[model samples]
Target: MFRLNRLTDYAVVVMARMANDGCKVRTAPQIAEDTGVPLPTVAKVLNALARDGLIVSQRGASGGYRLGAPPERITVAAIIQALEGPIALTACVDGQSGHCESESLCPMRGNWDRVNNAIRGALEGVTLEDMTAGLFVPMGERRSPAALQQASGK
Candidate 1:
């Protein structure tokens, strides 16, 4: 089955959490606590994301990590690529060979690229902001429409 690995899943969660509060520089331990992901795993995920320029890490007491760019500008495809590399379903899709002996003889050669590109395009269309829209409410933001109306005594 085509599914994201556990760490990649954690990365998405971590990223979404960061997106909700993009201004604050968050430490891995704080992120782990917030996202319920383990510390070691969060550290691992953070390092990879930093290396890929998805998140920027800093030092000193006030320094931590924050999104490299606005959440709306960062695509899910970039996140997946950061943690898992390319999105190709098969090695032979993008001129890659030697994984399968019959690669050259395969009838469906090159067709997988279309499939891969479609999936990539879909992922690219979804920004981190898109993924977290309405999923998180900040400190003073109303939780939902009902809550907003209720607060107004509607």
Candidate 2:
């Protein structure tokens, strides 16, 4: 099964919390408390995110971390890439040096790239804003078809 590692999952949770909080800088402890992730894990995830330019960190008594760019500009793919590197499902699709030893003999070589790109594109289409907003509307609040059409500018 294709699955995100625990840390990647935590990173998304952290980011979603941050996005919901707006541009305010948050300490790792604060993020951990809000997200129910462990303090150490949140710190580790924040460090990786900062290093990868997903979040900016400031030092000293009052300093904390904030999203490096607007939430809408940050894609799920970027967050995954920051914590887990490229989103390829297999070594053959990674396009890195010495990724696959059977490249010369494998008949499926290069074919995985198309699938990989498709997955990446899907991830890229989703922004942190969309993620934080979630996939389902509230139970009592359903948009009328006209409202949905208007929202989509159709």
Candidate 3:
């Protein structure tokens, strides 16, 4: 199945934690310790997030990272795209048309594009505020036992 890499997941976790903490400038080591992520990994993710304009960084004694914009304004898709490139299910669906030689005749390309759009829509629909406030759950759906089991590898 298509899934985000562990690095991307960790990036989200780190960002979410920061967002919840009011996006105050935070040291990577501190965020790492609080979030239970490796220090080096947190550093890497912080750099990437800063580079992508999702967060800003300062150096020296009072330096650290904070959200470039308000948490409510940043969508989950922006965070994912900041660390990972565009969210494309199949390579052909990526905006780089030159990547695929079969672009002119690929029958599945349109379908894949539709699916990608749907996924993108859902991700873009969610903001960091939704995450930080524990509003990620949809109104009618509950976390199923199977889903919990899968998440825990039970």
Candidate 4:
């Protein structure tokens, strides 16, 4: 099965949290508390993202993390790559060279690239904004829960 690891899932959730708040600088502990992820894991995920420029880090008394770019400018593929490296599914593809014993005889050896690229393209179509779109109110249409409740005549 093609599956992303737990850290990648956490990375998406963490970044989505940052994106939800307009990429505001947030401490790792604060992120952990808000996202319900463990503090150590949040730190680790933030480090990985910072190393890849997916997130920016600040140092000293006000140190914290934020997205390197706005949510709409960042693609899901970039996030996945920052945490998981390239998106190729098989050893025979992605320029890895000869990890598979049957590379010389396998008919499907060179075909996986098509599948990989298609998947990458699909992921690229989705932005962090797309990921967080339904999580809260829109820019102009923002409304509080109480307001919505009263409007519903509850």
lDDT of 4: 0.88
Kindly list the per-residue Cα lDDT of model 4 for residues 73-119, writing each as its tens digit: 99999989999998888866665666988778888877998999999
User: TM-score for all predictions?
Assistant: 0.88, 0.83, 0.80, 0.86
Ten-residue segment with the worst summed lDDT in candidate 2?
A: 130-139
Clashing pairs in 3: none
Candidate 1, TM-score vs. the true structure?
0.88
Give the clash count for model 4: 0
How far in Å is the alpha carbon of 52 misplaced in model 1? 0.2
In model 1, where do residues sit more than 4 Å from their true spots?
138-154
Model 2: residues with Cα > 4 Å off, grouped in runs: 94-97, 134-154
Tens-place lDDT per residue, model 3, 57-142, is: 98999898888888889999998998889987888774557777888887776678788889999999998877665423454776
Q: Name the candidate that leads on TM-score.
A: 1
Check candidate 4 and list the clashing pairs. none
lDDT digits (tens) for residues 1-154 of candidate 1? 9998998989999999999987799999999999889999999999999999999999999988999999989999999999999998988878777888888789998899999999999999999987876665665764878775565466
Quantify all predictions' global Cα lDDT against the true fold: 0.90, 0.88, 0.83, 0.88
